[model samples]
Target: MEAKQFQLAEELRKSIRGIVKTDEPMAKHTTFGIGGPADLYIEPADTDDLAQIIVWLNERQIPWFVLGDGANVLVADKGIRGAVIHMGKPFRKVKIDGEKVIVGSAAKLDKVVSATVDAGLAGLESTAGIPGTIGGAIVMNAGTYRGQIGDVTEKVCVVTTDGVQLEMTPENLQFRYRWSVFQEDKNKIIVEAYLGLKPGNKEELVRTMEYIRHRRNMNLPTVGRSAGCMFKNPDGYSAGQLIDEAGLKGTSIGDAVVADKHANFILNIGKASATEVKELAERVRGTIKGKFDIDLEYEVRIIGDW
Candidate 1:
Protein backbone atom coordinates (compact mmCIF):
# COMPACT_ATOMS: atom_id res chain seq x y z
CA MET A 1 0.00 0.00 0.00
CA GLU A 2 2.84 2.40 0.78
CA ALA A 3 4.55 1.66 -2.51
CA LYS A 4 1.29 2.07 -4.40
CA GLN A 5 0.65 5.43 -2.67
CA PHE A 6 4.13 6.64 -3.63
CA GLN A 7 3.52 5.59 -7.24
CA LEU A 8 0.23 7.47 -7.25
CA ALA A 9 1.95 10.58 -5.91
CA GLU A 10 4.53 10.29 -8.69
CA GLU A 11 1.75 10.00 -11.25
CA LEU A 12 0.08 13.10 -9.77
CA ARG A 13 3.38 15.01 -9.98
CA LYS A 14 3.63 14.16 -13.65
CA SER A 15 -0.05 14.83 -14.48
CA ILE A 16 -0.60 18.13 -12.68
CA ARG A 17 1.19 21.29 -13.80
CA GLY A 18 0.91 22.86 -10.34
CA ILE A 19 3.29 22.80 -7.38
CA VAL A 20 3.75 19.29 -5.98
CA LYS A 21 5.64 18.33 -2.85
CA THR A 22 6.35 15.13 -0.94
CA ASP A 23 6.99 14.97 2.82
CA GLU A 24 6.01 18.62 3.07
CA PRO A 25 5.80 19.82 6.68
CA MET A 26 2.24 20.69 7.63
CA ALA A 27 3.56 22.84 10.46
CA LYS A 28 5.05 25.32 7.98
CA HIS A 29 1.66 25.85 6.35
CA THR A 30 -0.42 26.03 9.54
CA THR A 31 -0.93 28.89 11.98
CA PHE A 32 0.09 26.72 14.97
CA GLY A 33 3.38 25.67 13.32
CA ILE A 34 3.05 22.23 14.94
CA GLY A 35 2.26 19.27 12.68
CA GLY A 36 4.00 16.38 10.90
CA PRO A 37 4.68 16.36 7.16
CA ALA A 38 2.00 15.47 4.61
CA ASP A 39 2.75 12.64 2.19
CA LEU A 40 1.60 14.75 -0.76
CA TYR A 41 0.84 18.46 -1.14
CA ILE A 42 -0.34 20.16 -4.34
CA GLU A 43 -1.40 23.71 -5.04
CA PRO A 44 -3.69 23.69 -8.08
CA ALA A 45 -3.30 26.39 -10.74
CA ASP A 46 -6.97 27.17 -11.33
CA THR A 47 -10.49 25.79 -11.00
CA ASP A 48 -10.01 23.68 -14.11
CA ASP A 49 -6.69 22.39 -12.83
CA LEU A 50 -8.24 21.67 -9.43
CA ALA A 51 -11.18 19.81 -10.98
CA GLN A 52 -8.86 17.70 -13.09
CA ILE A 53 -6.72 16.78 -10.10
CA ILE A 54 -9.76 15.84 -8.07
CA VAL A 55 -11.12 13.70 -10.89
CA TRP A 56 -7.83 11.88 -11.25
CA LEU A 57 -7.52 11.25 -7.51
CA ASN A 58 -11.12 10.08 -7.28
CA GLU A 59 -10.72 7.68 -10.20
CA ARG A 60 -7.72 6.09 -8.48
CA GLN A 61 -9.46 6.06 -5.10
CA ILE A 62 -6.75 8.29 -3.63
CA PRO A 63 -7.96 10.20 -0.58
CA TRP A 64 -7.49 13.99 -0.45
CA PHE A 65 -8.21 16.95 1.81
CA VAL A 66 -8.52 20.61 0.86
CA LEU A 67 -6.87 23.23 3.02
CA GLY A 68 -7.17 27.02 2.94
CA ASP A 69 -4.69 29.29 4.80
CA GLY A 70 -4.49 26.94 7.80
CA ALA A 71 -5.92 29.58 10.06
CA ASN A 72 -8.56 27.34 11.66
CA VAL A 73 -7.08 23.83 11.55
CA LEU A 74 -4.94 21.49 13.65
CA VAL A 75 -3.08 18.82 11.69
CA ALA A 76 -2.12 15.67 13.59
CA ASP A 77 1.35 14.57 14.70
CA LYS A 78 1.25 11.30 12.79
CA GLY A 79 0.91 13.26 9.49
CA ILE A 80 -1.47 12.52 6.62
CA ARG A 81 -1.56 9.97 3.85
CA GLY A 82 -2.60 10.68 0.22
CA ALA A 83 -3.01 14.13 -1.31
CA VAL A 84 -3.57 17.52 0.33
CA ILE A 85 -4.69 20.29 -2.01
CA HIS A 86 -3.87 23.86 -1.05
CA MET A 87 -5.63 26.31 -3.38
CA GLY A 88 -3.45 29.18 -4.52
CA LYS A 89 -3.16 32.41 -6.60
CA PRO A 90 -5.60 31.61 -9.41
CA PHE A 91 -8.46 31.44 -6.90
CA ARG A 92 -7.47 34.59 -5.00
CA LYS A 93 -9.15 37.05 -7.36
CA VAL A 94 -11.71 39.54 -6.00
CA LYS A 95 -13.84 41.95 -8.00
CA ILE A 96 -16.52 44.44 -7.16
CA ASP A 97 -19.49 45.05 -9.43
CA GLY A 98 -21.61 47.96 -8.16
CA GLU A 99 -23.00 46.76 -4.82
CA LYS A 100 -21.98 43.18 -5.28
CA VAL A 101 -18.59 41.54 -4.75
CA ILE A 102 -17.45 38.39 -6.52
CA VAL A 103 -14.70 36.73 -4.47
CA GLY A 104 -12.66 33.72 -5.37
CA SER A 105 -12.56 30.97 -2.71
CA ALA A 106 -8.82 31.42 -2.15
CA ALA A 107 -9.19 35.16 -1.61
CA LYS A 108 -8.31 36.08 1.97
CA LEU A 109 -11.11 37.32 4.19
CA ASP A 110 -8.98 40.30 5.28
CA LYS A 111 -8.40 41.25 1.65
CA VAL A 112 -12.08 40.83 0.76
CA VAL A 113 -13.20 42.91 3.71
CA SER A 114 -10.63 45.60 2.96
CA ALA A 115 -11.50 45.69 -0.73
CA THR A 116 -15.21 45.99 -0.01
CA VAL A 117 -14.61 48.62 2.64
CA ASP A 118 -12.39 50.60 0.29
CA ALA A 119 -15.18 50.42 -2.28
CA GLY A 120 -17.62 51.82 0.33
CA LEU A 121 -19.28 48.47 1.02
CA ALA A 122 -20.80 48.20 4.48
CA GLY A 123 -21.96 44.65 5.28
CA LEU A 124 -18.46 43.09 5.66
CA GLU A 125 -16.92 45.69 7.97
CA SER A 126 -17.66 43.69 11.09
CA THR A 127 -15.71 40.73 9.62
CA ALA A 128 -12.54 42.79 9.20
CA GLY A 129 -10.18 40.94 11.56
CA ILE A 130 -11.25 37.42 10.59
CA PRO A 131 -8.53 35.31 8.96
CA GLY A 132 -8.51 32.56 6.28
CA THR A 133 -10.18 32.70 2.82
CA ILE A 134 -13.66 33.35 1.50
CA GLY A 135 -14.29 29.63 1.01
CA GLY A 136 -13.35 28.78 4.62
CA ALA A 137 -15.38 31.70 5.95
CA ILE A 138 -18.38 30.52 3.93
CA VAL A 139 -17.87 26.88 4.92
CA MET A 140 -17.86 27.78 8.63
CA ASN A 141 -20.26 30.72 8.33
CA ALA A 142 -17.53 32.72 10.10
CA GLY A 143 -18.86 35.56 12.20
CA THR A 144 -17.70 38.11 14.74
CA TYR A 145 -19.00 41.26 16.41
CA ARG A 146 -22.63 41.29 15.22
CA GLY A 147 -22.45 40.04 11.59
CA GLN A 148 -21.69 36.81 9.72
CA ILE A 149 -20.49 35.92 6.22
CA GLY A 150 -23.81 34.17 5.53
CA ASP A 151 -25.66 37.41 6.08
CA VAL A 152 -24.13 39.01 2.97
CA THR A 153 -23.48 35.97 0.75
CA GLU A 154 -25.91 35.83 -2.17
CA LYS A 155 -24.60 32.70 -3.90
CA VAL A 156 -21.73 30.23 -3.88
CA CYS A 157 -20.11 28.32 -6.73
CA VAL A 158 -18.83 24.91 -5.75
CA VAL A 159 -17.45 21.86 -7.49
CA THR A 160 -19.27 18.64 -6.66
CA THR A 161 -17.40 15.41 -5.87
CA ASP A 162 -18.13 14.15 -9.37
CA GLY A 163 -16.41 17.24 -10.82
CA VAL A 164 -19.68 18.96 -11.71
CA GLN A 165 -20.08 22.67 -11.14
CA LEU A 166 -22.86 23.81 -8.79
CA GLU A 167 -24.23 27.29 -8.19
CA MET A 168 -26.18 27.45 -4.93
CA THR A 169 -28.11 30.31 -3.41
CA PRO A 170 -27.92 31.36 0.25
CA GLU A 171 -31.10 29.44 1.08
CA ASN A 172 -29.55 26.23 -0.25
CA LEU A 173 -26.47 26.68 1.92
CA GLN A 174 -28.41 26.33 5.20
CA PHE A 175 -25.84 28.21 7.34
CA ARG A 176 -26.02 28.35 11.14
CA TYR A 177 -23.66 28.81 14.05
CA ARG A 178 -20.27 28.15 12.48
CA TRP A 179 -21.67 25.46 10.25
CA SER A 180 -23.15 25.15 6.76
CA VAL A 181 -24.70 22.51 4.49
CA PHE A 182 -21.17 22.04 3.12
CA GLN A 183 -20.05 20.90 6.59
CA GLU A 184 -22.61 18.08 6.52
CA ASP A 185 -21.92 17.25 2.85
CA LYS A 186 -18.21 16.69 2.33
CA ASN A 187 -18.59 16.25 -1.41
CA LYS A 188 -18.58 19.98 -2.25
CA ILE A 189 -15.64 22.32 -2.80
CA ILE A 190 -16.26 26.06 -2.77
CA VAL A 191 -14.92 27.81 -5.86
CA GLU A 192 -16.18 31.35 -5.54
CA ALA A 193 -18.84 33.38 -3.76
CA TYR A 194 -21.12 36.30 -4.64
CA LEU A 195 -21.76 38.77 -1.84
CA GLY A 196 -24.49 41.38 -1.66
CA LEU A 197 -23.46 44.48 0.23
CA LYS A 198 -24.61 48.08 0.58
CA PRO A 199 -22.74 51.35 0.13
CA GLY A 200 -21.45 53.03 3.25
CA ASN A 201 -19.10 55.92 4.16
CA LYS A 202 -15.58 54.86 3.22
CA GLU A 203 -14.04 56.71 6.17
CA GLU A 204 -16.46 55.10 8.57
CA LEU A 205 -15.72 51.65 7.18
CA VAL A 206 -11.99 52.19 7.60
CA ARG A 207 -12.56 53.37 11.15
CA THR A 208 -14.60 50.27 11.89
CA MET A 209 -11.84 48.00 10.57
CA GLU A 210 -9.23 49.83 12.61
CA TYR A 211 -11.33 49.50 15.73
CA ILE A 212 -11.75 45.77 15.21
CA ARG A 213 -8.02 45.34 14.69
CA HIS A 214 -7.29 47.26 17.85
CA ARG A 215 -9.72 45.15 19.82
CA ARG A 216 -8.22 41.89 18.48
CA ASN A 217 -4.69 43.04 19.28
CA MET A 218 -5.70 43.80 22.83
CA ASN A 219 -7.74 40.64 23.45
CA LEU A 220 -5.97 37.94 21.40
CA PRO A 221 -2.32 37.02 21.10
CA THR A 222 -1.58 38.30 17.59
CA VAL A 223 2.08 37.31 17.94
CA GLY A 224 3.68 33.84 18.12
CA ARG A 225 2.54 30.58 16.48
CA SER A 226 -1.10 30.00 17.49
CA ALA A 227 -4.31 29.21 15.71
CA GLY A 228 -6.41 32.22 16.75
CA CYS A 229 -9.20 31.02 19.07
CA MET A 230 -8.85 27.40 20.21
CA PHE A 231 -12.39 26.86 21.52
CA LYS A 232 -15.77 28.19 20.50
CA ASN A 233 -17.54 30.44 23.00
CA PRO A 234 -20.45 28.42 24.32
CA ASP A 235 -23.96 29.89 24.35
CA GLY A 236 -24.24 32.95 26.59
CA TYR A 237 -20.67 32.44 27.82
CA SER A 238 -17.07 32.82 26.75
CA ALA A 239 -14.65 29.88 26.48
CA GLY A 240 -11.72 31.97 27.69
CA GLN A 241 -13.62 32.91 30.83
CA LEU A 242 -14.31 29.27 31.59
CA ILE A 243 -10.74 28.17 30.93
CA ASP A 244 -9.40 30.99 33.07
CA GLU A 245 -11.79 30.06 35.83
CA ALA A 246 -10.41 26.52 35.63
CA GLY A 247 -6.88 27.95 36.18
CA LEU A 248 -5.59 26.59 32.91
CA LYS A 249 -3.95 29.80 31.72
CA GLY A 250 -0.18 29.54 31.17
CA THR A 251 -0.51 25.77 31.33
CA SER A 252 2.16 24.03 29.32
CA ILE A 253 2.91 20.71 27.69
CA GLY A 254 6.38 20.85 26.18
CA ASP A 255 6.48 24.17 24.27
CA ALA A 256 2.72 24.43 23.88
CA VAL A 257 1.07 26.63 26.47
CA VAL A 258 -2.30 28.22 27.05
CA ALA A 259 -1.79 31.91 26.44
CA ASP A 260 -1.23 33.83 29.68
CA LYS A 261 -3.25 36.73 28.33
CA HIS A 262 -6.02 34.70 26.70
CA ALA A 263 -7.02 31.33 28.16
CA ASN A 264 -8.67 30.14 24.94
CA PHE A 265 -5.54 30.57 22.79
CA ILE A 266 -2.86 27.86 22.86
CA LEU A 267 0.47 29.32 21.86
CA ASN A 268 3.62 27.61 20.61
CA ILE A 269 6.38 28.97 22.75
CA GLY A 270 8.96 27.45 20.38
CA LYS A 271 9.36 24.23 18.43
CA ALA A 272 6.16 22.71 19.79
CA SER A 273 5.00 19.42 18.31
CA ALA A 274 1.42 18.60 17.32
CA THR A 275 1.35 16.09 20.18
CA GLU A 276 2.23 18.75 22.72
CA VAL A 277 -0.49 21.06 21.50
CA LYS A 278 -3.11 18.32 21.48
CA GLU A 279 -2.13 17.24 25.00
CA LEU A 280 -2.37 20.81 26.30
CA ALA A 281 -5.74 21.26 24.66
CA GLU A 282 -7.07 18.02 26.15
CA ARG A 283 -5.81 18.98 29.59
CA VAL A 284 -7.52 22.36 29.35
CA ARG A 285 -10.74 20.66 28.21
CA GLY A 286 -10.64 18.12 31.04
CA THR A 287 -10.00 20.84 33.60
CA ILE A 288 -12.80 23.03 32.26
CA LYS A 289 -15.23 20.12 32.04
CA GLY A 290 -14.42 18.96 35.55
CA LYS A 291 -14.97 22.41 36.99
CA PHE A 292 -17.96 23.59 34.92
CA ASP A 293 -19.59 20.34 33.75
CA ILE A 294 -19.58 21.80 30.22
CA ASP A 295 -17.56 20.27 27.44
CA LEU A 296 -15.61 22.95 25.62
CA GLU A 297 -15.99 22.54 21.89
CA TYR A 298 -13.00 23.22 19.68
CA GLU A 299 -13.33 25.97 17.11
CA VAL A 300 -10.09 25.00 15.37
CA ARG A 301 -10.60 22.14 12.92
CA ILE A 302 -8.44 19.09 13.78
CA ILE A 303 -7.49 16.94 10.78
CA GLY A 304 -4.79 14.65 9.34
CA ASP A 305 -3.89 11.21 10.75
CA TRP A 306 -4.22 10.38 14.48
Candidate 2:
Protein backbone atom coordinates (compact mmCIF):
# COMPACT_ATOMS: atom_id res chain seq x y z
CA MET A 1 0.00 0.00 0.00
CA GLU A 2 2.87 2.39 0.79
CA ALA A 3 4.54 1.63 -2.55
CA LYS A 4 1.25 2.23 -4.40
CA GLN A 5 0.79 5.56 -2.60
CA PHE A 6 4.30 6.62 -3.54
CA GLN A 7 3.62 5.81 -7.17
CA LEU A 8 0.46 7.90 -7.14
CA ALA A 9 2.30 10.75 -5.44
CA GLU A 10 4.95 10.67 -8.19
CA GLU A 11 2.29 10.88 -10.86
CA LEU A 12 0.63 13.79 -9.11
CA ARG A 13 3.97 15.55 -8.70
CA LYS A 14 4.37 15.77 -12.48
CA SER A 15 1.06 17.65 -12.78
CA ILE A 16 2.20 20.67 -10.73
CA ARG A 17 5.01 23.20 -11.30
CA GLY A 18 5.75 23.11 -7.55
CA ILE A 19 8.32 20.73 -6.06
CA VAL A 20 7.05 17.40 -4.79
CA LYS A 21 8.72 14.43 -3.15
CA THR A 22 7.77 10.94 -2.02
CA ASP A 23 9.05 9.66 1.34
CA GLU A 24 10.49 13.06 2.23
CA PRO A 25 12.06 13.11 5.69
CA MET A 26 9.99 15.12 8.17
CA ALA A 27 13.13 15.78 10.21
CA LYS A 28 14.63 17.96 7.45
CA HIS A 29 11.71 20.43 7.59
CA THR A 30 10.96 20.57 11.33
CA THR A 31 12.66 22.94 13.81
CA PHE A 32 13.38 19.99 16.12
CA GLY A 33 15.04 18.21 13.16
CA ILE A 34 13.41 14.90 14.05
CA GLY A 35 10.70 12.41 12.92
CA GLY A 36 10.34 9.89 10.08
CA PRO A 37 9.58 10.59 6.39
CA ALA A 38 6.33 11.91 4.97
CA ASP A 39 4.71 9.85 2.20
CA LEU A 40 4.25 12.87 -0.12
CA TYR A 41 5.58 16.41 0.33
CA ILE A 42 4.49 19.20 -2.03
CA GLU A 43 5.47 22.89 -2.17
CA PRO A 44 2.95 24.91 -4.15
CA ALA A 45 4.20 27.65 -6.46
CA ASP A 46 1.61 30.23 -5.37
CA THR A 47 -1.90 30.76 -4.00
CA ASP A 48 -3.51 29.68 -7.26
CA ASP A 49 -1.31 26.64 -7.50
CA LEU A 50 -2.11 25.75 -3.89
CA ALA A 51 -5.83 26.14 -4.54
CA GLN A 52 -5.65 23.88 -7.58
CA ILE A 53 -3.71 21.21 -5.69
CA ILE A 54 -6.13 21.39 -2.77
CA VAL A 55 -9.06 20.94 -5.14
CA TRP A 56 -7.43 18.02 -6.91
CA LEU A 57 -6.51 16.32 -3.66
CA ASN A 58 -10.03 16.87 -2.31
CA GLU A 59 -11.58 15.37 -5.42
CA ARG A 60 -9.38 12.29 -5.10
CA GLN A 61 -10.09 12.05 -1.35
CA ILE A 62 -6.37 12.34 -0.62
CA PRO A 63 -5.38 13.50 2.88
CA TRP A 64 -3.01 16.45 3.21
CA PHE A 65 -1.41 18.62 5.93
CA VAL A 66 -0.29 22.26 5.62
CA LEU A 67 3.20 22.99 6.95
CA GLY A 68 4.53 26.39 8.00
CA ASP A 69 8.13 26.85 9.18
CA GLY A 70 7.69 23.79 11.46
CA ALA A 71 8.65 25.68 14.62
CA ASN A 72 6.04 24.10 16.93
CA VAL A 73 5.27 20.66 15.58
CA LEU A 74 6.28 17.09 16.46
CA VAL A 75 5.83 14.59 13.64
CA ALA A 76 5.49 10.96 14.74
CA ASP A 77 8.10 8.18 14.51
CA LYS A 78 6.05 6.17 11.99
CA GLY A 79 5.68 9.37 9.86
CA ILE A 80 2.79 11.03 8.08
CA ARG A 81 0.82 8.80 5.69
CA GLY A 82 -0.46 11.22 3.01
CA ALA A 83 0.43 14.49 1.29
CA VAL A 84 2.19 17.33 3.16
CA ILE A 85 2.01 20.74 1.47
CA HIS A 86 4.79 23.15 2.43
CA MET A 87 4.22 26.79 1.47
CA GLY A 88 7.48 28.40 0.40
CA LYS A 89 8.59 31.68 -1.24
CA PRO A 90 5.43 32.24 -3.22
CA PHE A 91 3.32 32.30 -0.07
CA ARG A 92 5.73 34.50 1.91
CA LYS A 93 4.84 37.83 0.30
CA VAL A 94 4.45 40.71 2.79
CA LYS A 95 2.90 44.07 2.01
CA ILE A 96 2.38 47.14 4.17
CA ASP A 97 -0.55 49.40 3.28
CA GLY A 98 -0.68 52.26 5.77
CA GLU A 99 -1.42 50.94 9.26
CA LYS A 100 -2.73 47.68 7.80
CA VAL A 101 -0.33 44.90 6.83
CA ILE A 102 -1.31 42.18 4.40
CA VAL A 103 0.77 39.04 4.74
CA GLY A 104 0.78 35.56 3.31
CA SER A 105 0.60 32.56 5.62
CA ALA A 106 4.19 31.54 4.89
CA ALA A 107 5.58 34.97 5.84
CA LYS A 108 7.88 34.61 8.83
CA LEU A 109 6.72 36.13 12.12
CA ASP A 110 10.03 37.96 12.47
CA LYS A 111 9.63 39.38 8.97
CA VAL A 112 6.14 40.58 9.80
CA VAL A 113 7.38 42.18 13.02
CA SER A 114 10.26 43.91 11.27
CA ALA A 115 8.13 45.06 8.35
CA THR A 116 5.44 46.41 10.64
CA VAL A 117 7.93 48.20 12.89
CA ASP A 118 9.82 49.59 9.89
CA ALA A 119 6.53 50.92 8.60
CA GLY A 120 6.06 52.67 11.99
CA LEU A 121 3.39 50.25 13.15
CA ALA A 122 3.34 49.12 16.80
CA GLY A 123 1.18 46.05 17.53
CA LEU A 124 3.61 43.37 16.32
CA GLU A 125 6.76 44.64 18.02
CA SER A 126 6.44 42.12 20.82
CA THR A 127 6.48 39.22 18.36
CA ALA A 128 10.07 39.91 17.37
CA GLY A 129 12.49 36.95 17.36
CA ILE A 130 9.65 34.38 17.30
CA PRO A 131 10.17 31.67 14.68
CA GLY A 132 7.58 30.19 12.30
CA THR A 133 5.22 31.93 9.84
CA ILE A 134 2.26 34.27 10.32
CA GLY A 135 -0.25 31.47 9.71
CA GLY A 136 1.16 29.32 12.50
CA ALA A 137 1.25 32.34 14.79
CA ILE A 138 -2.39 33.14 14.14
CA VAL A 139 -3.49 29.53 14.58
CA MET A 140 -1.64 29.22 17.86
CA ASN A 141 -2.46 32.83 18.88
CA ALA A 142 1.29 33.20 19.38
CA GLY A 143 2.25 35.92 21.86
CA THR A 144 4.66 37.04 24.54
CA TYR A 145 5.01 39.88 27.09
CA ARG A 146 3.59 42.43 24.66
CA GLY A 147 0.46 40.77 23.26
CA GLN A 148 -0.93 37.99 21.07
CA ILE A 149 -1.27 37.56 17.29
CA GLY A 150 -5.02 37.66 17.89
CA ASP A 151 -4.75 41.28 19.03
CA VAL A 152 -3.42 42.39 15.64
CA THR A 153 -5.31 39.99 13.36
CA GLU A 154 -8.24 41.81 11.78
CA LYS A 155 -9.05 39.09 9.27
CA VAL A 156 -7.81 35.67 8.15
CA CYS A 157 -8.17 33.80 4.86
CA VAL A 158 -8.29 30.04 5.14
CA VAL A 159 -8.66 27.27 2.57
CA THR A 160 -10.93 24.47 3.68
CA THR A 161 -10.50 20.80 2.80
CA ASP A 162 -13.45 21.09 0.40
CA GLY A 163 -11.48 23.76 -1.54
CA VAL A 164 -13.67 26.56 -0.24
CA GLN A 165 -12.22 29.84 0.95
CA LEU A 166 -13.30 31.43 4.22
CA GLU A 167 -12.78 35.01 5.44
CA MET A 168 -12.89 34.66 9.22
CA THR A 169 -13.20 37.47 11.74
CA PRO A 170 -11.70 37.56 15.25
CA GLU A 171 -15.01 36.88 16.97
CA ASN A 172 -15.59 33.85 14.77
CA LEU A 173 -12.04 32.57 15.39
CA GLN A 174 -12.70 31.57 19.03
CA PHE A 175 -9.23 32.55 20.16
CA ARG A 176 -8.22 31.25 23.56
CA TYR A 177 -5.18 30.27 25.58
CA ARG A 178 -2.75 28.60 23.15
CA TRP A 179 -5.61 27.77 20.74
CA SER A 180 -7.92 29.13 18.06
CA VAL A 181 -10.80 27.94 15.88
CA PHE A 182 -8.26 27.08 13.18
CA GLN A 183 -6.52 24.69 15.59
CA GLU A 184 -9.88 23.07 16.39
CA ASP A 185 -10.80 22.61 12.73
CA LYS A 186 -8.54 20.04 11.05
CA ASN A 187 -9.77 20.80 7.52
CA LYS A 188 -9.02 24.55 7.61
CA ILE A 189 -5.65 25.91 6.43
CA ILE A 190 -4.65 29.55 7.03
CA VAL A 191 -3.52 31.12 3.74
CA GLU A 192 -3.18 34.81 4.58
CA ALA A 193 -3.92 37.44 7.22
CA TYR A 194 -4.76 41.13 7.46
CA LEU A 195 -3.26 42.77 10.54
CA GLY A 196 -4.49 46.06 11.91
CA LEU A 197 -1.81 47.84 13.89
CA LYS A 198 -1.54 51.18 15.59
CA PRO A 199 0.93 53.83 14.51
CA GLY A 200 3.98 54.28 16.77
CA ASN A 201 7.36 56.03 16.93
CA LYS A 202 9.88 53.99 14.90
CA GLU A 203 12.71 54.40 17.43
CA GLU A 204 10.54 53.29 20.34
CA LEU A 205 9.29 50.25 18.37
CA VAL A 206 12.85 49.23 17.51
CA ARG A 207 13.93 49.59 21.12
CA THR A 208 10.94 47.50 22.29
CA MET A 209 11.71 44.72 19.83
CA GLU A 210 15.37 44.81 20.80
CA TYR A 211 14.49 44.44 24.46
CA ILE A 212 12.24 41.47 23.64
CA ARG A 213 15.07 39.81 21.71
CA HIS A 214 17.45 40.31 24.63
CA ARG A 215 14.96 38.78 27.11
CA ARG A 216 14.18 35.79 24.82
CA ASN A 217 17.88 35.04 24.28
CA MET A 218 18.48 35.06 28.01
CA ASN A 219 15.52 32.80 28.84
CA LEU A 220 15.18 30.30 25.97
CA PRO A 221 17.47 27.71 24.36
CA THR A 222 17.99 29.45 21.02
CA VAL A 223 21.10 27.53 19.91
CA GLY A 224 19.72 23.98 19.86
CA ARG A 225 16.99 22.26 17.83
CA SER A 226 13.85 23.03 19.80
CA ALA A 227 10.14 23.56 19.20
CA GLY A 228 9.99 26.60 21.52
CA CYS A 229 8.04 26.10 24.75
CA MET A 230 7.13 22.42 25.18
CA PHE A 231 4.25 23.00 27.56
CA LYS A 232 1.73 25.80 27.93
CA ASN A 233 2.02 27.82 31.15
CA PRO A 234 -0.79 26.70 33.35
CA ASP A 235 -2.96 29.60 34.61
CA GLY A 236 -1.14 31.71 37.18
CA TYR A 237 1.92 29.44 37.01
CA SER A 238 4.83 29.09 34.62
CA ALA A 239 5.48 25.60 33.20
CA GLY A 240 9.24 26.10 33.47
CA GLN A 241 9.12 26.99 37.14
CA LEU A 242 6.89 23.99 37.89
CA ILE A 243 9.17 21.58 35.98
CA ASP A 244 12.23 23.02 37.71
CA GLU A 245 10.58 22.75 41.11
CA ALA A 246 9.73 19.11 40.35
CA GLY A 247 13.48 18.54 39.71
CA LEU A 248 12.93 17.54 36.06
CA LYS A 249 15.34 20.07 34.59
CA GLY A 250 18.21 18.66 32.49
CA THR A 251 16.35 15.32 32.37
CA SER A 252 17.04 13.23 29.28
CA ILE A 253 15.45 10.44 27.27
CA GLY A 254 17.81 9.29 24.52
CA ASP A 255 19.02 12.55 22.91
CA ALA A 256 15.98 14.59 23.96
CA VAL A 257 16.41 16.61 27.11
CA VAL A 258 14.55 19.16 29.22
CA ALA A 259 16.55 22.28 28.50
CA ASP A 260 18.70 23.47 31.42
CA LYS A 261 18.12 27.09 30.40
CA HIS A 262 14.36 26.65 30.32
CA ALA A 263 12.73 23.58 31.81
CA ASN A 264 9.58 24.15 29.66
CA PHE A 265 11.58 23.70 26.46
CA ILE A 266 12.58 20.18 25.29
CA LEU A 267 15.69 20.34 23.11
CA ASN A 268 16.84 17.76 20.57
CA ILE A 269 20.43 17.03 21.61
CA GLY A 270 21.33 15.93 18.05
CA LYS A 271 19.94 12.60 16.72
CA ALA A 272 16.90 12.76 18.99
CA SER A 273 13.73 10.89 17.89
CA ALA A 274 10.16 12.13 18.19
CA THR A 275 9.32 9.13 20.43
CA GLU A 276 12.09 10.07 22.83
CA VAL A 277 10.86 13.64 23.06
CA LYS A 278 7.28 12.56 23.61
CA GLU A 279 8.30 10.12 26.32
CA LEU A 280 10.37 12.77 28.09
CA ALA A 281 7.49 15.24 27.83
CA GLU A 282 5.12 12.61 29.30
CA ARG A 283 7.49 11.93 32.15
CA VAL A 284 7.74 15.64 32.93
CA ARG A 285 4.00 15.97 32.76
CA GLY A 286 3.57 12.97 35.05
CA THR A 287 6.06 14.31 37.56
CA ILE A 288 4.50 17.77 37.55
CA LYS A 289 1.02 16.32 37.89
CA GLY A 290 2.03 14.00 40.70
CA LYS A 291 3.90 16.71 42.58
CA PHE A 292 1.64 19.72 42.01
CA ASP A 293 -1.68 18.18 40.94
CA ILE A 294 -1.34 20.46 37.93
CA ASP A 295 -1.53 18.95 34.45
CA LEU A 296 0.84 20.48 31.94
CA GLU A 297 -0.71 20.69 28.51
CA TYR A 298 1.45 20.55 25.40
CA GLU A 299 1.79 23.80 23.48
CA VAL A 300 3.49 22.14 20.53
CA ARG A 301 1.43 20.36 17.91
CA ILE A 302 2.11 16.60 17.93
CA ILE A 303 0.90 14.93 14.69
CA GLY A 304 1.17 11.69 12.66
CA ASP A 305 0.60 8.08 13.68
CA TRP A 306 2.23 6.74 16.83
Report, for every candidate in turn, its global Cα lDDT versus the true structure: 0.87, 0.88
Listed in order, each prediction's TM-score against the native is 0.96, 0.96
Q: Model 2 Cα displacement at 60 (Å)?
A: 2.9
How many pairs in model 2 have backbone atoms within 3 A of each other, for residues 3 or more apart or on separate chains, i.e. clashes?
Answer: 0
Runs of candidate 1 exceeding 4 Å displacement:
1-3
- Candidate 2 residue runs with Cα over 4 Å from true position: none
Model 1 lowest lDDT segment of ten? 1-10
- State the lDDT of candidate 2 residue by residue for 37-131, as single tens digits: 88889998876677778887888877888889999999998889888999888889899999889999999999889889988899998889999
RMSD of each: 1.4, 1.3
Q: Give the Cα error of residue 1 in candidate 2, in Å.
A: 2.7
lDDT per residue for candidate 1 within 194-271, as digits (tens), equals: 999999999999999889978878887865688888998888889999988888888898889999889889999898
* Candidate 1 residue-wise lDDT at 252: 92
